[model samples]
Target: MIVPTRSSFSALSCLMGRLFSVYAGYEQQDAHEFLLNFMDKLHEDLNRAPHRKGPPVPLPALVDEAASLNVRINHFWCQHVDRHLSVISDLFEGLLVSSLTCLVCRKSSSSFEVFSCLSLPIPANKGSVCYLQDCLKLFLETESMSGEAAWHCPSCRQKRKAEKRMIIARLPKILVIQFNRFRCETAWQSKKLQTYVQFPISGFDINCFVDREQVETQPRPAYRLYAFLNHYGTLATGHYIAYCRAGHGGQWYMYDDASVTEVTLSESDKRNAYILFYTSVDMRHQFSSHP
Candidate 1:
């Protein structure tokens, strides 16, 4: 029955203030939102290059179409590191490569963006069941961008139909995945999908979801689930609970407000999962010291 000391409790309260200046006064908070805000603030506060003098240095131009994908990825990543260097960036940040290919010219342009979490969309299913890989695949699926969503191809010199696809270009030490369960069905209506998204507790490999051409060559990394946050009830009224691994290769425990209990998650419990936190199996030693 380990409990946080008074100092630790106060530190958590201060961290919450970093996330939100005005507390909701015991009103239920979205766990995902809180996590994101806290992470962002933590990065900002702990940034090594917090204040830069003079105007920001311009990024290197990516005009060379013949350059290899890894070259471009590294160029962008180096530029990013020059401005934002923090443990948060080192551990949690991952790069995504988004390619837009014009259907007419067949010419493609790619852009890289850094992300702290991967928000995956659940594909429409006849039954209320799907796997985590299905959601990841759905997220990485290419979509035809036409009509209003069309892209103006530089090669075609016109608004042409394009195929847009996104793939992971860099892997992070800690991967945070969020399920897009809340849906806006109508202008005034929204609903949460109770789809059972079965995820791997161990040996979770995301290599297939990554752009092998862009990423550096290395042995495949396996991730083990460390923690997951679940939301119960509707969008308006929901309670958040966390299931955290006790330690490296340890039992899972459910953490509710003011109560903690050992838990072997049932299928029903997994259905409520909102955010999943996974750590690289090779990095498991790092988390063994912390509960």
Candidate 2:
């Protein structure tokens, strides 16, 4: 297997620090934050269409109610890819559809947003143990906008009570989920929630959270956990470690700052899971039952 030498790893780290000044020194950083920044920079550096220099012209709104959901999604995706097409997006990017309905007008509008990672909030009501599905449910629950938070309705011509719902419109080959473990109670105070979140090790189905209207005709996507990062300590000080499978359905290994060890994950270690990485399962049998 090809692996980076110690010198090569150090050189790459230095190069990253040079490119992103915030990572210049040996200061502790958030792994998710670093991952996002690194990916963004790498995407820009490796963008397939480097000649496109100006801001892309926005595509006109889809006004034809007769259009199918899948057609609309494809249109929006094509517009998005026209400007930002890259291998990174092909693998990690997915689209989120946000639907908002004004209570006064009863008119609804939907918008498409792209995401590379999902930062899911851990429900405060959850006790010591929580399930990943529970967090996803909370994230997808319809929210009401009222009072000062009301949305301005174009049809109603005023700020009004609205209902908002978001769902996955596209599924990426690689899915990255981050738990919002670090919370800020105040401007100067924050705490880390150490809730034990149990996630599936294999055959995780995300279709439950997808927009059923759009995917009813498409194949269901399944994911399998291949790696996860864990955090130890409080918000101010912490150490990060990773547990990864060696290969497809392989043994798990723990990677610390400098040491790597093969070990089975215990319940205690599982409690620290902060971020998870899942790859799409592409077996033909995985889709046979969906239709």
Per-residue lDDT tens digits for candidate 2, residues 1-291, read 233477877887898899988889988888999999988987887677534456666777778864666777788877778678666776789888888889887987778889999989898888989999998999989999999999999888899999998878888878999999999999999999988999998889988788676544354468898889999998778998899887667788888876778899777767899999998854244345332
Query: What local distance difference test score does each model get?
Result: 0.83, 0.83
Off by over 4 Å in 1: 5-11, 22-24, 49-65, 214-220, 281-291
C-alpha RMSD by candidate, in order: 3.0, 4.5
Off by over 4 Å in 2: 1-3, 50-69, 214-217, 281-291
